[model samples]
Target: MSSNTTQMSIVCISEMKNSKRVAVEEEIIGMVKLNPFLYERKHEMYKNKCMRNKKFNELGKKLNVPAQQLKARWRTLKDKFFQEFKAELIPSGSADEAVKSKWKWMERLRFLENIYTPVDNSPCSSLNISKTVQELQQNMTSLVDRAKIIAEPSVPKSAAQLFFESLAKQTEEAELTPAEFCNLQIEILKALKAASIPNYLQMFCLQQI
Candidate 1:
């Protein structure tokens, strides 16, 4: 073939490949939309992928389908789900609303999963929030104490004093009497518990905090 004809052929081949990919993607999405079982499996895979779980193949196996096919289309369906998820998050004319509050990454995920999940319900929604928050705070406090011990050899006494002083300042600014503060903490814990946050997820949230 002549040079121009060869270049045209290559371009045509590339276009054909792209067309095929697009068609396959559309087909996969169509299948997921129509099949509840497939969508459920896809949801499990997506959640496992997000957590960087080592045994994600287990989810694929649970689907009872060809492994290769499940692996190939899982990502595409997740992308489509997230796209629809973004639309649900901030529909037309809600750009201002989305920007109004700074949302954390996991918080956004929780928001999306809560509204619509391919499976029955959001996984994190089962967590006991009040207990999780309390444990998280206690863990953080323990961590800080350990850090103090670890750093005592290197950190100056004045610097240590300054850090504790800052914490005290924060406590003062909270402006609640000791009884009121305890009551407030109890109320916060109750609200969290009511949220139905699961234990493992509560730890995950604490680690993030």
Candidate 2:
């Protein structure tokens, strides 16, 4: 064949391969869409390895691909789609988009954002908060026990001052944003107010407001 004909033949082969890859991706997505439990966090199937694998096996039978292969494609497709999805969400003009945000997969996987996006959880919604509260309770309990003792004539610090002095020491190295501090304070104050005994620090903070 002539050099020009040889180049044309190679181009045709490449295009055919690309077309087949697109078709396979479409088939994979179509199968997964029918079984959202495969990706959705809220689905029990997602948490159950046995059930999820059973479903993948079923999908593989129909797609004529191995279960592991389908799982891999799911991951790769979601990974690429999320990259574009995030870039698309960035504050930018339409002209700033990275070549239609990789239109190939974004359009197909855009709807998966709810399932794939990392959960935005409150800072206080963690084990650290529990530990913080537990420490706070222990400190407060120690203070209440101390309060029962008769005050020495030389005790210059006021009840509020002493309580806050301990707090300042406890939180000395802790770095908390204003919002996180306020959220934690609100939760702590609410719990204190709910209890039958009134707290001196709570009363002091409320008086300052």
Candidate 3:
């Protein structure tokens, strides 16, 4: 009876977490609709900082809140939104159902994971792939270093275009919106689909007000 009760408690906790995540996501969606600038590309905000600041100031006056506070709230919401976004990418069902072969890009993931895994040098003759994990780790470190440059608070004039192009090349796709591009880039940098990157570039653009 105790074991069963403990299992039920764990399930209840998981359900509660999911429910809270859903509510937060709904709030974030509403907020984005209320302020479209909250969802705009980092490049757009960077190029039009002055105009964006004026708009924020106007909205701030009406809401009786400082523009900085509004900006900070948006950043917090954005982080939570992306966290949920990453969580949803995880496969929840059976293996066959989890394998989404319809997407060409996803088909490459298995092959890439294999390449990223290094053969082990362990004494066992069974051939372990754990030893060479360092190779992939080093590659991810390099990618993160490059991504950090683009994600810096003081981004350059053409930094957005450059980052987008790099992501497209890395993912072998194009025409992704800023959010999509950022998601893919973050996945590549971390070598996992569930890692979330700090939205410093977006926040940097927003806080310019």
Candidate 4:
């Protein structure tokens, strides 16, 4: 029947795509082995923008995939591997058999298990946090003014919504590295989640007079 044939075709297509992803990931990991700078975190020599771009271009030509797409795919694969196991390395034994079996890319992307960047304890980091708070406070001040102006309780936006919109706008407009952008997103979510209760209280109290 057509229904059974269609299901079979879908499975075949899924398998083909998964196989292609595996090939691409393997190619990337092999290249990283040859060029450690591609994944090294603290190496000054590996931080050369020119060399990095050249390597990525080389890879793009060889794989017939855009460099940015390759980078994004690698990010996704790394996320899967890390989510499976929180350790610095994947277990080779049978303990994580379920994880290894469920996520086929686990062994292939195990090299990324230790890519955790340590927290920066420098004064500049402190200043950056202070600046972020200042910018957020400024945004909230404007939103707060709007809230005060709204006479009806049902009309004003919640503080969390305002905060998310402002922060997301900043994120979208800024030219940030992928890692920095990801960290900012995490911070944004955490701040919004923590403020949820207070946000409701603030909205409930809005123009209660």
Best by TM-score: 2
Which ten-residue region of model 4 has the weakest summed lDDT? 6-15
Pitting candidate 1 against candidate 4, the one with the higher TM-score is: 4
Give the per-residue Cα lDDT of candidate 1 at 5: 50
Q: Which regions of candidate 2 deviate over 4 angstroms?
A: 1-16, 93-100, 116-209
Q: What is the lDDT of residue 163 in candidate 2?
A: 66
Worst 10 residues of 2 by lDDT: 6-15
Which is the winner by TM-score between candidate 3 and candidate 4?
A: 4
Backbone N/Cα/C clashes per model? 8, 0, 1, 0
What TM-score would you give candidate 3 relative to the actual structure?
0.33
Give the clashing residue pairs of candidate 3, or none: 120-128
| TM-score of each model, paired residue for residue | 0.31, 0.45, 0.33, 0.42
Candidate 2 residues 94-165, lDDT tens each? 343234585776777766766433233544444232344445554444444445332465667656446655
Better of 2 and 3 by TM-score: 2
Mark the regions of model 1 whose C-alpha exceeds 4 Å error after superposition.
1-16, 41-70, 83-95, 98-121, 130-209
Per-residue lDDT tens digits of candidate 4, residues 1-209? 34545322212212348678678788876776677677766566667989887887788777767777666766676555555644222223445222344566667656654454324532223422324534544444445444543445676666645554554455456655554444443333333333442444333322131
* Candidate 1, 1-209: lDDT as tens digits: 55655322112212346666455445444444443344343445454453333233443344333435544565545544454444333313423232222332233233224323212232322332222444445433433333334236575554324444543455456564433333333333333334544333323322322
Clashes of 3: 1
Error of 4 at 14 (Å): 11
Where does model 4 exceed 4 Å of error? 1-16, 87-101, 117-209
> For model 1, how many clashes?
8
Give the candidate order by descending TM-score. Answer: 2, 4, 3, 1
